[model samples]
Each structure stands twice: as structure tokens, then as C-alpha cells.
Target chain A: MRINLASIHVDDQEKALRFYTDVLGFLPKNDVPMGEHRWLTVVSPEEPDGVELVLEPDDHPAVRPYTEALVADGIPFTSFAVADVHAEFDRLKGLGVTFTQEPTVMGPVTTAVLDDTCGNLIQIAAMEAPAS
Target chain B: MGDVFKALADPTRRAILDELQERNGQTLFELCTRLISKHGLSSSRQAVSQHLDVLEAAGLVHTRREGRYKFHDLDTSPLRTITDRWQLPTD
Candidate 1:
């Protein structure tokens, strides 16, 4: 089976769309009206057909507690691969993004965690080549 | 002071302090990541958190709540108790 879709629970769909597209630079892929909410999704501009990220609603009673606990502990809900973690961290910070963890080298990877503003923390990471 | 020595008895707790020394303010997630990746610690997140509690009790680590996020910071003042009790002789 191929993995074509991934999802994150966002507090607000409208706000999530703006952040995913305008702030984080993802392209809109799908938007279907579904009762009180919409089936909203976005794809990376670089890989339009690679994978779709669903902006799922966090209206369920359990979602708030789950997300809040993770946020309180500075745990990210999910991670996105980036070309350069430091560059992305700087760029996001320029746009008023709040980071829970700064760009730090962890063995073979460099990572940073940022607040998505939709009730979840997202991690950005880049793999570094091991020294010979 | 006894609590300080008891807390320092664990290797994982000391590793947490070392990582905090490298970067003063860190989240539990960051500390756990550093311990697993850099120090080869296989402890779970909950275990690391309990270690943090021990450090906090010893006054070697301080936890701060900034808005919705909580951060851990290293504090070495407790170590001074050791120096205050025993003085080194000068040549």
C-alpha cells in the first residue's frame, strides 16, 4: 500500500488553510464541504502529487486534552522534512512563528519545533551526512 | 543537600543535566532527544520526566511555564553546598 495522505488535527480549518498556504508555503489540494467542517488538505509546492496533508478538525472532546498535554510538554504532533532546519527556523521566526525548540543537532539530524497556532506543535527536521 | 546527592546518583539524571548545560533552556522532548541520540540513553519519555522531577526536587533544575509550553533550565547553585561544606587547601 502507498502512503498518499497524512493528517493533523487543527483547531480551525480557515486559520489552518492560511497558515499552511501563506505562512508555511503549502499548496491547496482539496476542499470539500462536510457538514459543519470541510475536508481540507494541502500539498507541498515542491511535490504537488507526493502526499496530501489533511487539516482535520479538532472538535472532538478528546482532541483538546490530547493536544494540550502534548503542547504542555513541548511534544510535536508530527514532523515535516526540510532541506535545512536552521534556514527554515530563521524564516519561520521572521514571520512571527514561535518555536518551542530551536534548531539543534541531534546525532545525524538537525531539528526545530514550532507552534502551528492551530493547537499543535510541528517539528521540522533535516538529515545531516555522517562524517567519514 | 542529601536530596542533591541522591538525585545525582542516576546516570540518566546526570545526562539530563549535561544536556541542559549545553543549552540552558530545553523542553522535556528536547532533553529526551538529546539523551537518546547523543548519550545513547534508551529511557522512555515518562522515565526522563521522572528524572526531571528528581532534578527539580534537588534544585539542580528549574521548570518554567511560559504560556502553554513548559521549559526546563539548569541551575548549579545546589552544587555550592558541597563546596561550602568542604574547603580545598591552598599551597
Candidate 2:
């Protein structure tokens, strides 16, 4: 089955909109209103026709504790694959995105973690093996 | 916020953070109840306590005691710093 949409819970939809678009550089794809919350979604600028990232509200009572436990244990809520860990790290750092981990190579891959500000720790990773 | 909140890079911690954010001052027992009922997390107090220790060490969570009551408070300045960076000029 092909993946189409993935959702990330946010404390505030507006904040998620700004952070996902401005800091992470994703483009807003859908903004239809859904009662108190909007049917919001974002797409990578490079993949407008590809997968969409839905910014859902963390209104459910369970969301806070679910996210809090993960944060306390130093685990990322989710991860993103980037072209280059070092470059993306520096780029995000330059944009004032705080990183919990630096680009550390682990065999064939490298990874780093950053706070999403809307109550999530997001990891950006990349493959590091040289092409033959 | 980066160094102090390094442990905060986890979603579970973010949720615990909400407890502190909402109540500002809570006992460990209160935190446990919130985690179980609110987030549906089944972690025991010991497991949740460990998370608090990490946050406490990072200065993101502070504790105070008045008489027999022990309270925990969340410091959001560091969290605010993260959002500050993303405050780009909106069109």
C-alpha cells in the first residue's frame, strides 16, 4: 500500500502551520476549515505531489501524557529523512532550530534530533554510504 | 533551551511538560494520574519519576515544597526560544 498522509499532533495548529512552513520549509497544501480545527496539511516543497503532513490538534486528553513520556525518555516522536544530515543540521541550526543531537554517523547512516516546538522531537537522518 | 532541554527532544517528555505547563505546581502523584488518565500512558510512577529527574537536571522543571506538599513547575522560556526562531515574517 502506498503511503499518502501522515499526521503529527500539535498543541496549536497555527503554530504548527508556521513552524512546518517557515522553519521546516514545507508548503501549505490544504487549509479547509474543520470546526474549531482546520483540515490542515503541508507538503514538502520538493514533493508537492507526494505525501502530505497533516497538522492535527493535540486536543485529546491522551496526547499530552503520550508525548510527555517520550520526551522525558529522550526519544524522538518521529523522524524525517534528509539529503544530508550535516547540511540539514547546519541549515536548521542557522534558522534557529535547536538540535538535541548533532550529526553522528552510525555505519551506513547519520541522524540528529530537533524540537518541533509544538510538542515533538523530530529527527532528521540520512544515509552515508558511498555510492559504488 | 537546546542544552538544558536536550532531554525534551522526546514526545513523551513534551506531554509531561504539559502537566507542568497546565498546573504549574504539581506533586509527583498528580503527574502520575495525569499521565495515566489524560495520555493513556501506563508507565508506573518509577518510570515517570525518571523522566522528571532528567527534566529537573536540565533546569526545565523546578520543584518546591510547602509544608507537606511538593510541587513541580515548568519553565517554558527555553521552549519559547524554540518558537522564537520559527517566527518568520508571515506574508
lDDT of 1 by residue, B1-91 (tens): 3399999999999999989999988988999899989999999999999999999999999999999999999999999887788966766
TM-score between model 2 and native = 0.59
Q: List the residue pairs that clash in candidate 1.
A: none
* TM-score for chain A, candidates 1 onward in order: 0.96, 0.94
On the 0 to 100 scale, the lDDT of residue A90 in model 2 is 89
**What global local distance difference test value does model 1 have?**
0.94
In order, what fnat does every candidate score? 0.84, 0.00
Q: For model 1 chain B, where is the 10-residue window of minimal lDDT?
A: B82-91
Assess every candidate by TM-score: 0.96, 0.59
Predicted candidate 1: what Cα RMSD to the true structure?
1.5
Clashes per candidate (backbone, < 3 Å) = 0, 16
**What digit string (tens of lDDT, one per residue) describes model 2 on residues B1-52?**
2365476876667788987787676556557656776777888888888887
iRMS per model, in Å, is: 0.5, 13.9
